[model samples]
Target: MNDLDKVESILFSQEKRFRLVDIPGAGRGLISTSLIQPGDIILRDKPVILGPGVAEDGTYCSGCGDISGSNLNLMENCSCGLRFCSVSCKQSWHTEEECRIVSSIPEPKPNQNYWLITLRGLVSEDPRIGFLQELTVQEGAGRSKEEDEVVKLLSSFGFKEKSILTVYRQLTANTFRRGRGRGLCAGVAMVNHSCSPNSRVWWDESGSLVLSARVKITPGDEITLTYCSPLLGQPSRRNKLLQSKGFICRCPRCQDGTELGTYMSSIRCTKCKPGLICPVGLDEDKLGWICSSCGFKPNPEKVSGLLKKVEDELYGLEKEKDPGRKLLLIQQYIEKNKKLFSSDHFLQLRAGDLMVGLMNKLAPSTSCIQTKEYYTRQTLKVLETLDPGLSRFKGFQLFKLYQILFEKIVHSAQGSLKAEEQFQLVQDMQTSLLESKFLLSGDRFAPPEIVENANLLVRALNQEQVEQIQDKINQKYKIVKSVYQCI
Candidate 1:
């Protein structure tokens, strides 16, 4: 059988809803054989080969591959110099035989985890290596200093240069970053990329890669994943795709200058305040933008310079430790960029995200609260357009909105609120909570507090304790409304 056929045989041995097929332009991709609903598990795969990515620095456990903060530097006492969380993991995955082999290396480096991982795959007689060999090599892009060091170290161990290069290339091309490291999952590696993808993949606590449908997939649809951040605009996304994945994405979102009507890449026109200047063509490398009104095109360098400045500011804001300082800088940034970028621009969305997070720490006036609400709602709207169904991003944003609504209800309860107004806010809170809970279900990437808070709120809503608060408020107002205000 062919390599893809072998991969299919290995994958189909497990429960899967998709089949591997070659498309015209996009080499090999997975196609759904059956209708797949959002949140449905498309595939659950364990890594055949697991190792550190470029510059990972041995932060993850060698055995069981757990990268949680608590597991770091746990047991560096192994003769092989591999890290392990416990004795059981050391015994289970990193065996005495493997340790002996690793220890026998002529001159091992401090962080030889990359070399060790490549060594395992190189020396192994496992049948899966045949399928792995079919993966693309990271060639012609020039190697990093780390990669060169890895090759030299492996060569010292007396392995063939050809075999070493082959294994190294396959690992680099096909691996997905689980945490501080990457893993080569044969089935998942075959699925191609899209800026807006139908499927999402995350590594579970058990070290298994869980691939689920982010949106509904009818039969014959190609299963795709985003290789880069979905929040990035076309230029950044395209640049990332080309540099890393070896292709420029012409995905539907990438082709559209307006970024699917969200104006994620568009800047507001200076000549006509109402108009947005957007890219004119499909060429990601070329600089061509035209305003929808007044036919004005700003200098490309000027646009790039502005974006770079804002990007640098955002980067600095992200690194700032103090929430208060971060909030101040973000407010300053919003005021500075308001005239330049459209309200729904990706940069603004990022700032909105930062601002939404700061809401928990700072006490704002009623106007500030309303502004936060506006940003939250706009962010949620943009996310819905970018990632439609069961998105982890949307789930977090929903939780933020839920927090805002909850706080608004509490604040209004202190004052005299119209029973109907209070009831609407409570309804919005429950909806956001429940929706977030459902979206965040089985998602390991979501923060623990978000999941916990969502569950708590859902339970409280179910018990109707907040409903009691609403009744008290309603009685005080003496209005015939089944008002549901949070206490």
Candidate 2:
């Protein structure tokens, strides 16, 4: 067999069950031999590459991936002596009975670590929660909760006290240190990384983590998803992965920024004449050129330093009760960074969203006013650039448009003509939402609060009107499915 075939054989023998093949210029990579549809179980191998430390502290859930506090709290250990987030999960575990065998394993010696046991054994348990068994085996004899740091961190993130303790006890019972799980499915682990990935990773109702291509992925494309938050740019991502994963990623996306010399080492010139030239500071390497017209070149360090300051100010603005103040801050950030960032930059897009949200909050009744009309147009422009019809932003902008039109119909002092115009606007907004496949797309990029907010908005809309909208949405979904089948 050839080298590629040899690699595939080794991986399959290791129980990864994925086949490696060449993708022309992309080199050798794993691909699904079976017809893997959206949200299908592509692979379920152990982690080929595990991080140095367990994600003891994070903004998200390690269990269910929920950012909301309403998620279940930790419960007592099940019959198998395994702890879960709640009684529901514990009961579910009971049916599997995988934990019984796992929990019964003898603990390791004082010097032995729990993660090591997992690495050593061939655990044939549920991949979703099977990692817990490794801990169970390692915790063999000794059982002591010596002030759990991970639990404390989770508690600080507003996780329920019981939930925090439960997860901690469970993790504590196993391994406290990090270790890699060999023989993990290459289709899952070998998937590449991207700052703007076309796919999203999600856990279905069955608790199995599934990957869905958010955008159209070519047949031979190396399927990838953003491991880190996309809201963060290059340097932040590198720092995080380095600190947590202990690997300096040489991924194309990461390398691209470094090669461009845009890894927090350059900024646009604010003083440059509108069309003449844009200047950037020259450091160890000449990052960019200086503008001749205004002789403008910003210090890269100074520009990078303002990022945190801008973020802090934005946070404060979000918390402010006065909508005008919030809007001002949003505009201030946008105008100040206009030269520093491109119009299509994610930060600018986010600021545009903030502006629309603040407008809605400030004057829901007058959002369609000529003064606010410009903002909506700007929002539409940004959302279109980001993903056009296949983005959560598109749904949000549509919702905003619906709100503006609805408010005008309800509160306007004008005659029935204005009401008619508003009605047409609402219809247009609904059509836009349906065309975008907003509901079927699933909420990945949007914050949990935003999803909740959208749900509430849907609930508040006129029942008959909503039913009509749902019908249209369903029709559009059918068409989209048909198109995908044809493709």
> lDDT of each model, Cα atoms only?
0.72, 0.44
Q: In model 1, where is the ten-residue run with the lowest total lDDT?
A: 477-486
* Model 2 TM-score relative to the real fold: 0.53
Candidate 1 positional error at 391, Å:
1.4
lDDT of 1: 0.72
Q: Summarize candidate 2's per-residue lDDT along 35-108 as a digit string, tens digits.
A: 33333334433333221123333222211223223432443445543334555533432344235343444453
Model 1 lDDT, residue 349, Cα: 80
Any runs in candidate 1 off by more than 4 Å, and if so which?
1-3, 51-58, 64-77, 91-140, 159-169, 179-181, 204-206, 299-302, 362-372, 449-487
For candidate 2, give the lDDT.
0.44
Worst 10 residues of 2 by lDDT: 175-184
Clashing pairs in 2: 45-185, 46-184, 74-163, 106-140, 107-140, 107-141, 135-174
| Model 1 lDDT tens row, 275-388 | 999866666455568897778988877877777777878988988998888888998988888888888888888887788778766785676678779898988888778875
Q: Give me the runs in candidate 2 sitting further than 4 Å from their true place.
A: 1-86, 91-187, 228-268, 275-298, 315-345, 367-380, 383-389, 392-424, 436-487
